[model samples]
Target: MDIENMRAFITVAEHQSISHAAKELHQLQSNMTAKIKKIESEFNKELFYRKPRGMELNEEGKKLYAQFKKIVLLWEETRSMMNEDSPVLRLGLMVSKNPPNFDDAMKALYETYENLMVTIKTGSTPKIEEELVNGTIDIGFLVGKTDMNSLHYKKYGTEKLVLVGKNIDKPLEEILKHDNLIISSENCYYKKILDVLLEDHKAIRSDFVEIAALESMMNMCQLGMGVTLIPESDTARLGIRHYKVIDHSCCEIEKFISYRKNHKITGVEQQLMNRIVTAN
Candidate 1:
């Protein structure tokens, strides 16, 4: 079957509307309809049931959709691996949460493979997960637990979460009454964790000052602008004092280096992965 036709079919199946899929693919509706018809004819099966509002997949279409999605993922992986002229390794790192030595990993990758090109994107874990699923990034450095079974991960280690501020001697309740809660936006995974912690302590955040960069967050905390939560290990590196959160029962978060399971690991890719996973 033609890959383009299969792609159209997948798009139609996902949207359940030929017009919507056509718009997404930037193709005419008539062309999209013809492609779906050609695929159904080739398979000798009725893939979708025509409806007044939209198309709905039958059992046959559901089976084909599942198989074809895998085929598309595999094709993308193969093409990426074979691009030797510009061996770009795309990486997504969660900057809001402290990860283990991602800069060191990139440095090692560049040193080991001089010709390789590296592209790095920073965001929260969910953003990284989205990019990994769509094959936009080859690797992700994330903190916290992910239930995405399609991606395989190597755990770096678990670290304790602590509240850091310039005045480390302040009482926990006094610290909670402060105006500033320096952290990422509402959708951040770490933000969600902090929300639960705050609720358990019966503390209400007076203000949330959004900061994307970890270094900036630390700097803000040091200047006494606001206090932020960070890993205990990072506090030592930054020469700042960190106190354990009130509820010590659930304060640990896991760090990981993750990639799609379908992608084949090249020698250079393997080396990069090793550096990511083995590095402290």
Candidate 2:
């Protein structure tokens, strides 16, 4: 079936006026009328009964309209979703509070391929991970290790997790008595570490406050909103001093590029992934 002709029929059916449909579609009145006739001739059926005030669906028209409406809507939705899957590769990045080296990796990936659309979404681990799992994002650079079986990851490197706060803080024990720990949402990997700390120390869950991203959390911490646990790289960038955990339980974590393992990799997506891995 001619999708365009059906589209015109559907619109005319909806508006009940060829003139109205033409106006809405930015088409000429005669053009709209001709398209409707084209559909009718093809089906050997007249879809609409013309009247002075407007048009109404005939019996044959009503049945065909019901069937075609579902098909057209589905086609439109499919097209819309496919629009997100343009031949251009889509990439999602989860940059820490610090400068990310993944930009270099992207530059490397695009150097050899003209068909690439790199989209960077910078946020805390939880936000980025959600995008990767939901398939909203094609690729992601996340902080910390993940156990998701469907997704595979290659740990590029580790960034030291430092204790960040304003002035003082000779040792962690002196501060652990405090009531709050500012961190990312629960979905975040780093936040998981904090949860462990809170559990071990018997810290109140009510004292935890999750921020949107590293920058916001760090800024809030800087303004004395609350103390935050962040990567050592963030400490320098936020212009704040940091200290190491005294207990020797390592706070450093591995960063990784993660994607669905079972997903059928398109040729272009595969090539792009290869380029990303090679560049990294």
> Best by TM-score, which number?
1
Query: How well does candidate 2 score on lDDT at residue 58?
Result: 96
What TM-scores do the predictions have?
0.62, 0.55
Query: Per-residue lDDT tens digits of candidate 2, residues 73-101?
Result: 55643453455354455556554542364
RMSD values for the candidates in order, in angstroms, are 12.4, 19.2
Error of 1 at 155 (Å): 1.8
Q: Give the worst 10-residue stretch by lDDT in candidate 2.
A: 271-280
lDDT agreement of model 1 with the native: 0.74
Q: What tens-digit string does per-residue lDDT give for candidate 1 at 1-280?
A: 8777877998788678999888656699999999999988888999898999999999999999878866765554455456555667788877754356557756755664467787778888888888898999888878875669788775667777788767656776676676377887666776777677677779887467888777888888887787777777776777875554645655788877788878765545644654444455
In candidate 1, the residue pairs with backbone N, CA or C atoms under 3 Å apart (3 or more residues apart, or in different chains) clash, namely none
Give lDDT per model, in order.
Answer: 0.74, 0.65
Best model per lDDT: 1
